[model samples]
Target: MASTRPLLLLVLCSLALADAHFKVFNLRGSSLSSSILGHADAYVKVFCGSATLGETSVRNNNPNPWWEEEFTHFKAQQNDVLRLEVHDSDFGFDDFLGVCQRQIKLGTNSHDCFLEKGGTLHYTYTLG
Candidate 1:
C-alpha cells in the first residue's frame, strides 16, 4: 500500500508539471528602409520569456516579407510573453528594424499587431 501511494503521487505530479506545446505561425509586413544600400534583407527573431526560440530564414532585398514558418513544440506557460524582433541582415552588424510582443493566455489565439518602428506582424497560436 505504501508503494502504491508513492506511485500514485508521482503520476499526479507528472500531470501537474506537464509542459504545454504550441505552434506560432507568423507573417511580417514591410520594414522601413534600413539597408545602407536601400532595400533590406530582413528576418525575424522570436523569444519566449527571455529565452531565444529561433529565427526565420532571411528574406533578401525585400522590405515586406511573409514567413510561413511554424514554431512547433514550443514550450510555454500561461501568461508568458512572446516577443518578435525584426532585423536587417548585414555583413558585420545587423540593423534593428522593429519589435512586437504579446502575452500568452488560455485557448487558441490569433493577433495582428504592429512592429516597433515600421511594419506589422501577425501571429496565430495553437495550444495543445
Candidate 2:
C-alpha cells in the first residue's frame, strides 16, 4: 500500500507538469524607430525562458513591419516566461529596439507591448 501510494503521487505530479503547445502568430509593429539613413530593418526573436522558439525574417527599410509568420514551441510549460525581442538588423552590431516579457497562460492571449525605445508590437498567442 505504501509503495502504491508513492507511485500514484508520481503519476499525478507528472500529469501536472505535462507539456503544452505554444504558438505565437500575427506579429506586427507600428511607428518603429528609423535609422539615421532611413527606416529600420526590423526582425523579431521569440523565446521561452532560455530556449529560442523562433525568429522572423528581417524587413528592410520599413517603419511598419508586418511578419506573416508563426513561431511554435511544442514543449512549453504553463509556468514558463515568454520573451519577445525586437531588433534592427544593422551592418555590424544589431540595434535592440525593445522587448516584452509575459508569463505563459492557457487559452488565447494578446499583447500590445510598447517598446522601450519607440514603437508598439502587437501579437497573439495560444497555449493548449
Candidate 3:
C-alpha cells in the first residue's frame, strides 16, 4: 500500500512551486516568542465524505519534550480527511517552535494553526 508520510511530503514539496492563494506565511525566522515554547500534540484522521477513512496518533519518543514527533510515514489516503489537532488542552499555550518545513504536507484542508505568530502552516491539495 502507498504510505501516507511520503505522500504528504510529496504534496508539501509541490506546494512551494505553486502560486500561494492565501499567503499563510512568508519564509522568515520569527523572533523570540512569549509563550514557553509550547508543543502541540496532534493526530492524523483520514476521512472521505461522511465515512472515516482512518486515524493515527503522531507517535513520540519522549512525552516530556513532545517536540520531536517524527511524521515520516503517516497513514493516509487520497480522498481521506486529515486533521492534525493538539491533543492536550493544557499545552495549547506552551512554547512551540515553528513546524519543520520538511514535515508539512499541503493536502486537502491541510493547515497548521500555530498559536500566536511563530510559524506558517498551509496546504493545497488536488484530489483525484
Candidate 4:
C-alpha cells in the first residue's frame, strides 16, 4: 500500500542517518597550573554539546597527570561538538584551569589543547 511504502522509506532513511559511537581515551596533562596551596588536584570533564559524556577522577597533588580511563557516548552525531574542561579541585572551590572544543569527525583524532591559565592537555578520540 502507499502508506506502507512511505513508512518503509522513512525507516530506511533513519537507519542511514543513525547516530555514531564516540570514544575518548589516553587523557593526559602536562605543566598544568599550580593551586594556591601547592600542586593542582586535577580532573577532566568531557561533554558532547550540553550533555556530559564522562569525567576523570581527580589526581591529587599533581601538576602533571595521566589518566588511564576512557569514556564513550553511543548516541553522538558527527555534527556534535566535543568539549573538554580541566579543573583543579580544592576543599573550598574548584579552580577552572582551561577548556577545549572540537568538531566531531569520523575516524581517529588527537589534540593537544593549551589551557587558559597554563599547560597542555593531550587526548585522543575515535568516532565510528
Candidate 5:
C-alpha cells in the first residue's frame, strides 16, 4: 500500500474538481521528526494554482495569522502534496517550510480536506 502523502497529490489528477490549486505538501514525513505541524506568528497568503485560497483578509473570513487563515476549508486529492511557500506579511514569498499530510474521511466527496480527528499526520519538513 502507498503512503498517504504522495498519493494525496496524485489522486487529484484523475479528478478535476477544480484547478484553483497548485502546490502540494511534498515533505514526506511518516514519523515525528519530519512534520509541518507547528506555530507561526506571521501573516501570509496561500495560493491554489493562481487563485488566492487563503489570506489574512476579511473576504475569506481570515482571522489573521498565516496558519489559521490559510488551512481553513482547505482540501486535497488522495495524494496531492502541497508545496508550502511561507511569506512575510509586508514582503514576498520567503521559504518552503513544510507540508500538510491529509487525513480525510473514507467517503469524503467534497474538496474540503482536513486532518483526521486524533489521526496523526505530521506536516513538518525536517527535525533538528
Candidate 6:
C-alpha cells in the first residue's frame, strides 16, 4: 500500500519556507544627543541583502526627531538581516550618521540598536 506521509512532509516544508512581510512602524532617536545644540537633517535608509528596500524622509535640522513613516516589504525572509542607516543630507555630499542591523523574525516586535556613532536609534518592526 502507498503512504501519504511523504506528500504531507513536502507540504509542511513548503509552508515553512514561505516568505514573510516586514513592516517598520516608526523610528526615534535618529540624531545624536550631542547634536542637541545643533540640529541634524536626518533620514533613514533600509537595506535587505543587496537590495535597498525603503527610506524615510529627511527630518530637517531636528535632533531627537521622530519619523512616523511606515514601510512594508513583501520579500522579507526569516532570519534575514535588516540594516538601517542614518545620514545627514548636505549640499554636495551626505554625511554618514549611524547604522544598525537586526535579524528578522515572525510576529510583532520592537528593537533598539546602537549606531556606529555614539547615538541610539529606536525603531519598531513587525513580521507577519
Q: What is the Cα-based TM-score of model 6? A: 0.80
Between candidates 1 and 6, the TM-score winner: 6
* Model 6 worst lDDT window (10 residues): 30-39
Model 1 stretches with alpha carbons more than 4 Å out? 1-18, 31-36
lDDT of each: 0.75, 0.91, 0.33, 0.90, 0.31, 0.78
Instruction: Please provide, for model 6 over 1-128, each residue's C-alpha lDDT reduced to its tens digit, 9 standing for 90 to 100.
Output: 99999999999987766876778877887445344436767888988655677788888877777887887787778788888898876678777888888888888878887777656789888887
TM-score winner between candidates 4 and 5: 4
lDDT of 5 by residue, 7-85 (tens): 8777875465532232322221121121233322233344432335454331122212223232423343333333333
Please provide, for model 1 over 13-116, each residue's C-alpha lDDT reduced to its tens digit, 9 standing for 90 to 100.
87755657766786666554655587778888888776787899998888777887887555677677878788888999998877878877756887876756
Q: Which candidate would rank higher by lDDT, 4 or 6?
A: 4
Best by lDDT: 2
> Looking at model 4, how many pairs of residues clash?
0
* Candidate 4 lDDT by residue in tens digits, 42-126: 9999998668988999999998899988999888888789999999998888999999999988889999999998999999999
What TM-score does prediction 5 earn? 0.26
Worst 10 residues of 5 by lDDT: 26-35
The global Cα lDDT (0 to 1) of model 2 is 0.91
Show where candidate 6 strays beyond 4 Å: 1-13, 30-37
Candidate 2 C-alpha lDDT tens digits along 2-109 = 568888999998886688888999999999998898888999999986789889999999999999989998888887899999999999999999999999899899
Estimate the TM-score of every prediction: 0.76, 0.86, 0.26, 0.86, 0.26, 0.80
In candidate 1, which residue pairs clash?
99-116
